[model samples]
Target: MVGVLERLERLRAAADLVAGRIPDALAGKVDDVLARSNRRLAVGPQTVVALAGATGSGKSSLFNALTGTRLAEQGPRRPTTATTLAASFTATNADLLDFLGVPRRHEVAPPEPDMTDLVLLDLPDHDSTATAHREEVDRLVRVVDQFVWVLDPQKYADAALHQRYLRPLAEHREVITVVLNQADRLTAVELSQCLAHIRRLLDDDGLTGVPLLATSAVTGEGVADLRRHLSRLAAGKRAASARLAADVTVLAAELDRHVGPARGSGADRRVVDDLTRRLAGAAGVPVVVDAVRDSVRHRGTLATGWPVVSWLAKLRPDPLQRLGLGRRPELESPGLRHSSLPARSAAAHSQLSSALRAVTAELGEDLPGPWRDAVAAGVREAEPTLGDRLDRAIVETELPAERSPAWWTLVRVIQWLLIAVVVVGLGWLTLNAVLGYFGLGVLPMFPLGPEDGLRVPVPTLLVAGGVVAGLLVSGLSRLVISAAAGAAARRARKRLEYAVAEVAEERVLAPARAEVARHDAARAALDRLR
Candidate 1:
């Protein structure tokens, strides 16, 4: 029961969320659906004995007879009720009737304490195809705890009654009561035969376990027996209203399963998840993280005469094209008789409206003004703008790190190496000049100075030194950068896991949790009402 209520709560919350955001008619529909839900929750769960039959069934007579009141008008003529008729037992039950939208009239019953708890509804002639009539009967049956299917002797086995009402509401068999009315109009022998025939037809209708009773409102025969049964039902100590509410809610939820998970999902969240991951990768977090680490390890290398390398490391990558982040995602493919999220969302919203249409149809009242306004507010609150929301979500996203250029360090290292080579070459050139001035030159590769033999130019030696430094720096930078990049990739991947997890919680998990909480609240409210 708790689980069932929880599900209903979720339905109510979802309805509330979409109610105002949808179009006018849609909002109106959702507003009523929620109202009915609350009414179902709050309606102190009485048993409804719906008086059903064709036009001449004298069903109303039975209702008046059972309560011992002239609540329903009777005639020697046809169609006493031009519209669907109803009279409930409680007056301060304004909230419940307001919930049900059956008009209020204080039709006094002749003081039967046994009848106080029972709300016997006098239904319209089922044969009448009046839109209003059919709708009222449907509304009554849905909320009613016990259905006392009133039938006349002649149309007791009517095909329309069985096909239209009986078969579909088979779930309410325990609460279904088949009353064979106008028994006094038949001879005793004929009454017995007709009762037997009705029983046989009931069996064929698969309503065998349902209680079938005989009565004549005019003769008052068997009325006490029926009243006696009703009295015992009311006298039961169980929470009848609570149980019925739970039952209706459970059935409604079962029907909701056909809608599937795609019904209430948000498109913004889906788009944002994919976008964040791609954007994070493109921002070059792996590269940036690696460089920060390497810079820390070789902190001295940059601080002490390696400003060039450090400066080059400061160049950030292009955020968009770095990891295919610039490309747009493929739109959901088109299909025959199938649709994408936008299309399905439209359909689902439409379906949501259609599902709730029965609520107003039953009650025969326009939605209360506040409720309609609230529904509009809710729809506006839940309005989906995947692009706008996605952009905002992206703007808020924090990448773990920003990567500098891969070649920047090499450029810096080469600059330092060039400086070292120039100094070395200058020393060598001065040594060669001094040695040649006194004929003691020993230039390692070319042993003689300019004066002693064939000499190397000082500028040429400097150039050679510069080439050596450049080559060494290039080779070393390649090795260092490789190691740095790999380490950065690993760290970035780990950090990215946390980022994704956080975003998922914010966008997906958080919304889902809220949905669950709303459902639980609704379920609790409904249970309290019950």
Candidate 2:
């Protein structure tokens, strides 16, 4: 189990982590409590107990009786003691008094030396009609190590005392003592009835186990008992720590109401995958993939088609260039060049928006209103930059068509050899026709089938065989290139999608997830205090 000091430290860490995220009022309270607690701990081990009550409650007289010295003055006025009067039982309490901001201080010698480290304060009336007096009491109440509430018979059950002061201090019962002052005024029967009523009222305020007694500052009816109680608290030397612990417990409870459940792992992987696909679509991945396929086929045709018709292929547009993609010198520097891919269609924007909303919904699920709003706000802030990020991802991705495969080179060589044979046969036929027209000796023929029965001319055979073989090779190359184009398109799609996924994670998921992590951190610290 964690100690009170450890819990207090955790509470401080939590408060700092959630400073700007929670409500201003709650955040301010956390700051004020921590500041007071730290300053109180720094002063000394001396227990600083305060006499807190409404006007005409005889707090000043009780203070004088407890110290055996007239440290605080008593008068017939409605409100007395606008400032605090301190009585330190020890010789070296000037530092503590200075820290408490009390200028009027006195040293006292008590019967018990064990109470030497005690420092008692006579505070202003908490319910005083004077605003300054009430403000002084309220300020000291927050930092005092313990409280002694002095009540009178007539107003023992005053609503302002119970509701405003006692009820809120219910968690600090261990550091609080209640006394019904002026007990000498009431008869025995009436005193018994008042004590019973006070008991019931304390129970209702959730301060059931707190010490209660009746004392008259003048006759000293229960003053001896109150002194002993205060002595025990001082001797133990744990009152300050106990008081701080109670303060932390109350703050933790209030903060826990605003903390939601923890989601430590961040965005779900499945949701991320869905988001990647949507982002890829918005980035025009499909268009890029189709361009890759068409670019490959266009280049393949120029490389392997018949020389006669190959010049015609140059007349058509290059698919990759049309999209402002492929291996361009300007595009070598990442993020500097934008593609000519068309503007994102309405459907693409809708999908992108829907995907982003899904991410926000998942992150904000089960969270408190403020934290959920924080997550959504983070996503919305990043939404405008997403389009630019996606475009950059697409431009930077390496497509397959950017580098030609080795097979295309080998096929191109074979096609040139076939074209060479066709050229030789066509020249031979033209030379033979010119010779025969000029009545020169005719070129010799070659035997084709059974030598004497069937013979064919050499030029005709050369011309016929080369034409048939060239056409056959061209047809086969078309099938292979088509398959290769499809495979290249598939590879390009994979790379583009990968790039888009990175954009989604960096631009969309990371920030939203960070907010969730922050909430979890604050919540976990508060949980330890519980």
Q: Among these predicted structures, which one has the highest lDDT? A: 2
Name the lDDT value of residue 311 in candidate 2.
68
* Model 2 worst lDDT run, 10 consecutive residues: 442-451
Q: What's the C-alpha lDDT at position 305 in model 2? A: 67
How would you encode candidate 2's per-residue C-alpha lDDT over 1-530 as one tens digit per residue? 67766887898899976877778999989898888777778888899899987788898999988898877889756776889988888785776788778888888897466678788999988888888888888888888899999998877788988888999999889889999999999999988899898999999999998999999998999999998888898999988989888888888888988785676746777888889988888888999999999998888888776656766989988898788888888545776978889999999999989998999998888888888888899889888988888887888888888887787677778777777777777787787788999999756655376666767666666767767766776678778889989999999999999889888777788888888889998888888778
Supply candidate 1's per-residue lDDT for 230: 74
lDDT of 1 by residue, 447-495 (tens): 3366877776655577575766665665665566556645654665566
The parts of candidate 1 lying over 4 Å away from their true place are 1-34, 37-48, 69-71, 83-112, 129-139, 142-146, 185-193, 196-208, 236-254, 259-530
Q: Rate the local accuracy (lDDT) of all candidates.
A: 0.55, 0.85
| Cα RMSD for predicted model 2 | 2.0
